[model samples]
Target chain A: MTTPRNALVPGGAADQGPASTTPSGDSRRLIYGHPSLLAERPTHYCPGCGHGIIHRLIAELLDELHLGPTTIGVASVGCSVFAYDYLGIDFVESPHGRAPAVATGVRRTRPDAFVFTYQGDGDLAAIGTAEIIHAAARGERISVVFVNNGIYGMTGGQMAPTTLLGQHTTSSPEGRDSSLAGYPIPITEMLALLPGVSYAARGSIADPSQIGKTKVMLRRAFEDQLGGGRTSIVEILSTCPVGWGMTPQESMDHVANEVVGVYPLGVLVDRRAAAAKGA
Target chain B: MTAVAERPRLMKGNEAMADAAIEAGCDAYFGYPITPQAELLERMARRMPELGRVFVQAESEVGAINMALGAAATGAKVLVSTSSPGMSLMAEAMSYMAGSELPIVLINVMRGGPGLGSIGPSQSDYFQATKGHGHGDYRVPVLAPSSISEAVALVADSFELAARYRTPVILLADGIQGQAMEPVMPTFRMPDWDTASWELTGADGREPRVVKSLHLRPEDLEVHNAHLQAKFATITEREVRWAGEQLEDAEVVVVAYGTAARVARTAIERARADGLHVGLFRPITLWPFPSKALAELAPRLRAIVVVELSAGQMVEDVRLAVERVPVFFHGRTGGMVPTPSEVVDRLRVAWALTAPTP
Candidate 1:
């Protein structure tokens, strides 16, 4: 069976550059290559950090879609603030909790240019609650790649708004108490209620298969912008090994087991088909 | 061919600046409604979309300023207007803009405020605008206009100054100016600002660009601050603006700005008609303070009486400008505006105090 047009096919995009032969001089076809849009440098992210996988997925999609030339990114104030450093596109680093507002400004000023914001759960659901809600309500024609790792990893794994009720974080050493800290925010489901949000989905980067599924949702969210739809967002449940006090492999397992239970992975909102039916 | 100037038309200060911002080639306008300056946001909401430009009445001042920051990063000329409390809300984004060196124009229609003080006219924000605008070692150009016509002209010119210096520029006025009506010639040519080298359009056929203020390394931050300081020094040398009336022969000078300056103007004239030599020294640009010009005139005057709608804020700057010049101050705080007659009484006391001993 043929794969989808926007699907991530190993390293098969047109912009993946040339294939390399083996050192033995055998003419073998290369099945995988680095994404040309991802910069070749050591990232500051800790080992087992899911930011690398998510970044690669976005870079691959941007390269495959040839969107690198016209994409403007708004990088948030968390560990992904340096997402701009890895992506080959124009970018602006926004103040803490202001990425959605900044992206709204960029998209409005340059409607022809594709815009996206990479933010963390703490940045989006806590301080920037107003900005995210309003941008989604306005149905800004931009995409959002929200990495919800359930903690503020950059600030030493503090309790974020999406932290699970019984999750143990640096700030919640005795495990989170819903009595005081409140419950984990189901932000994606809440945002889907806005008519401006044409697409909203939740995905996980727990394993290779899950990463592939996440990429599919991300592609739909991004492609929705090209169709001039309203704000499209894909919330990615990620792993933070160092922040979670787990080994790299254990972190992956925890994300696959515990995180997904809290943030159930599925397409929560898809208004494209509804729009088509209405039309 | 000589261009015919447009006839001056009566307009409120808030609406006049809104029209002047559009005329100044503002590509986007983002603002939140606040007392005294709500008309400015309303005008932009109506005019900008009609002109095929961007306008957003943002959810709050925090959102509005950030939107302005985003638009400014994309090389769009942006305008944001608000009164005192709203300006207070914008301080965080202002600090970021100053650090990132994004050029945008902000109009702060001053009201009495320590904490939502009152909507009446006041110059209490003189310190806030000129000194501690935000939490940073950065300075934004502050222009104070005493009347609606001057506010129009200053608002138009503020865009160019912001672009030229690559810094945020503030048009600091008050409720008196915002609510007052005067005939203004909203006719000015938009200046050319070449932002090709730094603006974030896209990475099309070029390396990706980052417009950011995060310099993680201390050495790198030092270099960035050095660049900002050098720009501020250049602005201080080149952009000091002020106006003087009857300074050639004056025994006392009333130093002030914004609405306070308007009151000082009338009081100065009244003092002169009474055969006492009193002049008005009005600072148009309050950040660069116009210290040199005031210092130059210090030797000719026996006393300098600084007046304001706030409790002697700009007077400290005046004292610093003319050292040991018998500086006196008169002010009314908490939404109370000083009348010309009250200022005249202060000027009389200042003149008597400066008289030769015994």
Candidate 2:
């Protein structure tokens, strides 16, 4: 399988022309190629689902970082449960909401291995709130990739813990009333308050520019954990077109216009910088 | 690898088990503190870090069990100990471990519970342990040790059994056994497991190994369940363990396990001295239930009396094992332990009922 045309490159994919090969016929300098760590098989993710985009980013980083041979991934329940199938890495499928705890088990036992947990809103924010919080508080040497799509796409568009206050879904048909459902939790910000978290960031993939920024955030998270930092996390606000009852373009727009407002982007915490300065 | 002690040391059963686990080369331990078995976690906390092994006092039983599952997935020998209420909290992860076929050792220092009943010794979790504590079709080999020394030996065996079968194994004890102080010989088996085929170290030189139980298709799940059932069947055939005293010529045998068996041993000895033919049959492997062994001796015994700390939980398994043999049950529940004299009284009645009418 060939890499997508819009795949990330050093100077951004938009700057390169259709000529994928390098001028001197050097393979390493080719503009775009398939990620080495990603499997060639087609994924089961829905069309225009942000999970594919996020998976590609992670695979690309794993390839660049040479972590494919030493990375152990803990895949949480939900659409991303099949992450092992697409990531081509050793994976332990954890129980719903327990990926962080599972990752801790792996990281604690195999300190040389790079451990990460990929989780969704329902898996991370709702049922797994305690696991995620404690993992961050304990400063577990693991990276967490939290994908907040505002709805349970795999379970047929149920209201998620990260769903916007006025968002309507199967479970919240009359629109989520703040009085009954309470406000959406800013889990990343709350986790950032913990001293153990070395890097906590929020990013979006609603557009190309945002995707690039989000990839940078993901790279920072991976690098922080690899550098022996405790609990690096990147929360990515993503799109779910089928679950949200909208076209792919409309869903991306909704993520950009609505989701970004509730969950703002950028690095909220970077303790590594402070630690470096203190040293 | 070998039992050797210049002088036997009196240690708490939980502590002895922890020492045995360490001697068995446990690579990691994750547990939450609970009554009765809190000493086990404390012992690990003190010893594991000293040995440069992994030890984590998890947030809760749920966290502890999942962490153990994760460690086990990495092919590390892992241990987790908790009491009944905590065991209840760990049920979900136990199910996940069973489905994933991860070989982690769990010690359930059972306490009285219908829901926070009491933190005192009770064997009420027989049904829970033997009949699948968690949902789904799976089995976790349950080892019941009656004394501190036996618990020590079984703790080592638990790891071997777990690795041999590629499944979780439970060392089921009661609060009495967990808290009792007895002289124990320092002994444990060394773990020699070859986990290269499935352990999740890295995919550098081999295909990536995935430890998961999620089979989306019903047919696929059924096949997986069938494979698990087959493994369980082999475990039953190869791993049935029980100990019997004076069973050769005894007319009546007392069937018991764990703490209840300890009391039954004294009762059987006293009854034998009183010229009544009585024997004690202790099923060490609770999940397999040692049914074949019990059934084999059923025809020779006139009657079987099942004693338990619970209100007759393991008695059901006894009844199933000895189909036609008259089985009597005596139980004490809600943390109330039956005395040796109490068990003797039940044995006397069963023996009298089965006596020949001359």
Candidate 3:
């Protein structure tokens, strides 16, 4: 299964160091651009948020994979709710938590289409819990770009199912105690346990190097959908500057120092070996 | 087109609908059997494969409509038939298809509802059919046919509407209408498809296109919604359909739709026997609802009684249309269908009180 791959940023080797990879001198700082399939606009996420970076990574992958023609994005109600506007791909606004269900319908019907869903912690873990789990269990051929931003971002940061212990949010103003909140649910771990899932990975955009790697994994998820295999989810650890009541830079520091410890990033499931076996 | 030259035969409304769907080149039929309309699925299960179509007996109504959407995205003519509760299950998938602008047909042999309601014929989903059947700022073209023959014609029309509008189209009738037999002379035939405009024929002949409803920018979203609204506005102008009977010098006009409209028409004719001046307003397209025609009739009539199987749903439209013309309502919820005589009696009682013996 050979495809024509066209890299958007020439491997990102030039993107090195602490000040953060700024796309290069006079090359336009807007990470995701016109040629990248995303609609150019100020994202609806908080300052220093990972959603923007994640969107850029996905956009860059869409360009590289040549999935623009077949790309279909299912938008759910969350911080990534306005993803459709940015991705500029064909989109379907799914009901709260039903993005997976909607994505399944699109994938099953348009099997040739590269179908992916953009969802948040609450939208996936709570309201749309059944749809995502069932879709994964059924091994529906679709990709989900799940953002576990710890706290719900849209309606002022509330304690999400993915919110870590002692993390403070609007709903959990007094730090989230594990006993009262009953522990943060690691969605990737839960989903990976199911045989239906093909890939499950968590990544944060706080660091420049990790963001580059996140794009590679995101591309892999979309490839799984396009190749007509099993379900995949790339859970993104996003940031909340306004919700956390800090300047954008401070929030990035918070994700690097505080949030990273609780939600350690890694691949929970990988079916690449099985994919190789099948081939 | 007439290779079969098939002789006209008496058939159940639901079965005629299924046959018409097959004749319209429907590529797939997905459904789970339910009371009153189960025979329709029986007919499809027998004939679909022979016609080179996919007929799947889905695990549930949820699965059935989802399958229909899957088949429809490829621009395959698809139909899913169900009763009331099954329709409620269908609502979620229906909204998704509508949002994504996928064309598919839904044949709703309506029963009573709220819950487990009734399997018997009821025009109770008028509100749901006209409204909540699809979520968001979108409209489903709901077509109502009274007789088996109309079901044949309406099913074909629904597929056409679904294609033309790029939205879900409901061949919305009830159990009574679904099971009734009537004379059907196949007038209009299914047109050979032209997928040049819209249809996911895939990346074979041209560049691959993705149909989705994700709008991230507020301005872009506003533009998309406006574009959809414009299409709807065009729908209202070109798609509105209804028929009026004996309105000239009549004392009352009975505004009804679907199975209830059929019953109301019979009652209107019966009342004429007793020399009561009565007319009928029957809506064929319940969504762009024959409002203009009804509004025009409002000035001349004494009053309007919205006869339905549900609790006065379409009556709200009548009230809006006839503002100060005095609107009266008669309905029975949960599977109750008023007979011709019952309707005549209601009309007589209303006639006596409204304009008196003239």
Q: Write down the TM-score of every candidate.
A: 0.95, 0.96, 0.78
Q: What's the ranking of the predictions by lDDT, best on top? A: 2, 1, 3
Q: Which ten residues in a row have the lowest lDDT in candidate 2 chain B?
A: B187-196
Superior candidate under DockQ, 1 versus 3: 1
- What tens-digit string does per-residue lDDT give for candidate 3 at B237-284? 999998778888687888887778778888988899889889988889
Deviation from native of the Cα of residue B345 in model 2, angstroms: 1.7
Ranking according to DockQ, highest score first: 2, 1, 3
Please compute DockQ, using alpha carbons, for every candidate against the native two-chain complex.
0.79, 0.85, 0.16
> Stretches of candidate 1 above 4 Å error?
A1-30, A277-279, B1-4
For residues A140-244, could you state the per-residue lDDT of candidate 1 as single tens digits? 998999999999999899999999888899999999999989899999999999999999999998999999999999999989998878999999999888888
Which of candidates 2 and 3 reaches a greater lDDT? Answer: 2
Kindly report the docking quality category of candidate 2. Answer: high
In TM-score terms, which candidate is top?
2
lDDT of 2 by residue, B227-328 (tens): 999999999999999999888898999998888888898999899989989888999999898888889999998899999998888888898888788999
Model 1 accuracy (lDDT, Cα): 0.89
Error of 3 at A149 (Å): 1.4
| Candidate 2: clashing pairs of residues | none
Task: Evaluate model 3: give its lDDT.
Answer: 0.77
Interface RMSD of each: 0.6, 0.6, 4.5
Worst window of 10 by summed lDDT in candidate 2 chain A: A1-10
